[model samples]
Target chain A: MSFDTKENTPGTVPANGHSDTTPEARPLLIAIAGNPNAGKTTLFNALTGLRQKVANYPGVTVERKEGNWKFDPGRPAARLIDLPGLYSLDATSLDERLAREVLTGRLPGLPKPDLIIAVVDATNLERNLYLVTQLIEYNIPVVIALTMVDLAEKRDLKIDVEKLRSMLRIPVVRVRTREKTGLSEITEAVRGVILEEREADAFWIGNAGIDASQQADEIHLSLSDDEAANRQIFARYKFISDVYQASVGTFDTERANFSEKIDKILTHRFFGLLILIAILLLVFQTIFTWAALPMDLLDQGFGALGETARASMPEGILTDLVVDGIIAGVGGVLVFLPQILLLFLFISILEDTGYMARAAFLLDKLMSRVGLHGKAFLPLMSSFACAIPGIMATRTIENKRDRLATILIAPFMSCSARLPVYALMIAAFFAGQTVFGFISVGAVLMLAMYSLGIAVAIAVAFLLKKTILKSPPPPFVMELPPYRIPNLRTVIQNMLTRAWLFLKRAGTVILAISIILWALMYFPRSQAPVADESTAARVQLENSFAGRLGQTIEPVISPLGYDWKIGVAIIASFAAREVLVSTLSIIYNVGEEENEESPTLIGAIRGAHDSGGAKVWTPLTALSLMVFFVLAMQCMSTLAVVRRETNSWGWPIFMFVYMTVIAYAAAFATFQGGKLLGFS
Target chain B: MEKIKVLTLADVAAGTKAKVLRVSGSGPVPKRLMEMGIVPGVWIRVVKSAPFGDPIEVRLRGYSLAMRRNEAESIEVTE
Candidate 1:
């Protein structure tokens, strides 16, 4: 009933500046607004240090980041809300609209900000002031945090901050976050403005743009909201130019500068695209080679821990569950952490340095052909590392239709979780074969599988854009922020945050699902005595709940060249694609009782035969299995993330059904087509 | 006196400078264009074009902006 608690109060200041309010008093909310690449995030990170929380705005996928900033011991801590960067308040995109809504008290669960710290890029004062001027019209107290003054000076332009402050009639704090200069001053300015509760002066609205003002007034009476917004936009720009002329001194336009020099080669028509492809190849190669050692160590460590648990515990259901269900299941998900970390590292660096916009610009033509924005390219590429983060990264796409389409197709990329399944199959079927003198046949096959995933994703995006998600393409206008060296602190912080999320999922959802799956395969122990341990183990598995389910589903999947055992693995893999390899290893190892060390799981699979005495996992079947894993919506975590991101079960359910249908059809075609081509 | 020729932003060649006459479109597109400082009197230079010439880069207001040709066509400019 108390929606307006003291903590949620919009702009209430204590009557006495020296009042002994508790340190736990409600913190004032300050929202930081700026254009992309204006060093706003850098300033936020610098002020908050390590006290930030990243969450989604209610009912939207745009990230809402808030941190606590305590400038002085005597003053109340201020809660800083870092809104997504936007060019203006006219709200063309969802991100821009969210900022506008939060400022105007339209968004639920968020109060109107008490003070706005408008981070303006001093180098681009004319354009950055556009948003600052718009913020003034809302009647909220505004403090301009001027940044990039060094860059402006390097360009031979000098800015008189005192003159600008007098011209705008607002407090202006020139800040250099890198040098740690003027931060305390900005904080003091914020504190002063908050205590004073000063209101913005509506100087531009009355005196400037007289003709435009008359036109806006005439149109404001009869026009709809959209037309009125249009009228206000022109007036705001006209006012910004007048402010630019009065306070800014000397235009230095003689030099080409460093950014233009870099752009010449990076945006070249032919060479630019070639460099992009080479960069992608290097990224993938690093993921495979650089992460190989860490992945192997993790795999061995998990295997050793499972073995130790099995050896120490007495033979019983509890021991089997501990070793197989819990250890194997959680380990399966954690094995890809290294690859995920590296992927995010590369992405964050690219974004911080401002190359992402250029990449999007280069790829816009091809992406538009598939009915996606160029921004979709990076998210789709990230899907190859893992789909959960990739789906979250679609926040960069502004249009709802484009974002949804990108999300729906993101899972089609072959994620790292499927690597184990592909490796197992390739080792069984394609080992020792080579195309040229040097390239291994298995490596070629792996590349082909990755290409297949990308090809299918693009084709599906093309189809979905033209049909179900059809809408006119949104205007593609984006800023290419000047290049800067990525701050090490922000990159590492992002990498760790993503890694923590993955580990937490492994600990909770994956752990519970793994335990349940163990019970399914371990229940209904055999009553009749068997001749040996291997026979007894086989009988117990066949009579278990999972075996019965696999048998029931075998008839449906036979056309895809899968047997009951393969069917069981496929069903268990619905929790995670990597579980297919672990499930198969368990099924094969349980029925073998010979030698000190168990034969490799690949050998067991190779030795498997059907009731008719033909080898079960032939080359065609292995290829078909890989195809199924590539396309299927097998990860429960991805589905859960999609549900959360879209804020509805409808899109996740639709995604699951469509992906399953496509995966089954593709596998069936591959199996039947391969058989016709005389591959056994 | 020769009449000044007014052309859309898409008609400007790379490295050429043009002063904006007006932004002509409806909906949020025009509003957004104006917000990025493509107003009646600002000068913008065509910086570069993408491989297919769909999304082109331009330098204006001391910053770089990339926009599709369709969106650029809405901005009327005089060379």
Candidate 2:
């Protein structure tokens, strides 16, 4: 049977191969489906290196990865869509439902794929084949790409490919994606099937046991939809069992395997929780220690660039905008890249090695107590690096309420963007002080701030679960995939992709926001100029729009131990929390005649005094400000992502209000309480 | 012939093997469990329980799956 060309055209054409005009020259659409941790992504990355587009599916937070793969030279390129990894077509979660719709051509804007490449984990064939059986029911032409065959052999499980092919009546290509072997054979098989244009074999219907056929028919004829579904499911499983019996063999004892030997301690009741905490602590320590050098280099590089721009350009608004607004603002956000990259590196390794699932399993009990699934833990942990990816990672949580709760508390994890604010404040106020003789007081204060964020996040999550976002915790049925040595290429590629996305935002969104803030603080220059440059700078700032706005909000924030300058920094930081540092630098550095480097930005902040000649940034004020940063919903990008993920402004707006109120009250208490305790 | 002892998967002690007699729940949980190869006649073993004894891990079909005890309660098993 020749394939129906009209029904198989992909919605998007390959950008490089658009010149071909013949109907036979149309691109072929192939969708890859598989269970999670099956190396489907590795195969996809091998087939389409750096040529894929990752975007969200319409109206959902699930990522859509599409790329073009050329089977052979001069052959029409086939468009490959990597559908989300799912267990079955039962379609419980939004991602699974979307995968189902795309497979069946029910999702709008996506045509039915001409062929499906079902990536099956050879070691776990019995479970992976469940999805394959469901795919076979769709009657689409399927080419089975068997991955992890070597691993299966190591486990002493031998899978007879030829026997499996004859039994199932389909092509099965053994592939080792990391070594990039057997890929050409898979492509050739796909090309052969597409050219031959064969229909799905009806072997399953005829080869089924007579009893199963009779049962299926009876349910189809007389039963309701749910019963019919159950009957169909039973039939499929029976068929899978028959196929397994014929083509699969095992030689090892059915006892504890290597993974279990490791899991004995990893998943132990007491040790597992301790190990989890230790691992998280190690991750945090690495993020801070490893990222310090690169962060300092990035900071100095931006500072030098700003200095060069100031020395080269003429004294005008353009020079100020370029040096202070664009460089400083974007640099503020970009400086966190080293930490974000390291975070994703650890996350990618954890995921690639299959420990993430075990982590989820270990955390399920604690998470369920807070009305969330264990899967929510990973996404929330990811928020400590940055909330954008953390919000995106929430798609793994199947339950809507749990996912929302995770997304809502994700920003409270004290992301790396808040690092600059805390570092600057602590250096200014708590430097040279030591706790416990050897421990730096600043470091202790930083750790305490981070702990406060986690504590508040847990409390808020509990409150949300009890009130607005209340829902029964969904059953946590997750697979703990066997561990494998993580592929370095895959982990590095993932890190690079995330870093590129972060840099892209820095160049575009953060760049624009910094320019706007700069103009707000730069404009409204007085017609009559003052003689002294520093006096002119102060006068100019007071007359500007941002300055007036900060003064207006001064009364409101004064109770929290913040003056107009801090007030202005808070307002500017709404775009990104780290902008507060750059805002203070620009506000204080203006019209300074000295060009010395030793008296750094911290010294400038420490030297500044209020109108009454009292110190503006006391230890209490600094602590209060850090607390405010830890609690406040300050990042616009996070709000935008939350809006996009939830498909509404309501949740993000509500999040902003609640977080701001909490931050205000907490900071207020710290300042007032500290004053009463004689700290000031 | 001997009568097999029936117990819900939740009541089945860790490290004990049993065959699923029936998946009794009616919603998505049972359907999902069946999809993952937890059906009648499939042999399964309780691998371990979480720290608080809510979610228990099980080994079946050459892979491991972790589910809450309440969800496991729906799976009728016989040793």
* Strongest candidate by DockQ: 1
**Local accuracy of candidate 2 as per-residue lDDT tens digits, A232-337:** 5677778877888788755232678888889999999999989989999999899989998998899888888889999999998888889878887787778788
- For candidate 1, lDDT tens digit of each residue in A1-680? 01121121222332222134432456777899998778888899989988899877888767788999996578777889998898777665778889988877678987667778999999989889888877765567788999999999888778888888987778999999999898999988987886665654534342243443444446556886555655566666677766777777554432566887898998899999998889888998898899989988898888899889999999988898898789888887887899999999988888888888889999999999999999998889899899988887888787889999999999988888888788888888888888887899889888888888888888999999999999898679889888889988878877777667656644587888888887888887779888877666666667789888999999999999999999988989998987787667656754321211234777888899999998888989999999999989998888888887788999999999999999999999999999998987
Interface RMSD of 1: 1.6
**Residue pairs of candidate 2 with colliding backbone atoms:** none
In candidate 2, the second chain superimposes onto the true chain B with a TM-score of 0.94
Name the weakest run of 10 consecutive residues (lDDT summed) in model 2 chain A. Answer: A1-10
**Residue pairs in collision within model 1:** none
Residue A520 accuracy (lDDT) in model 2: 84
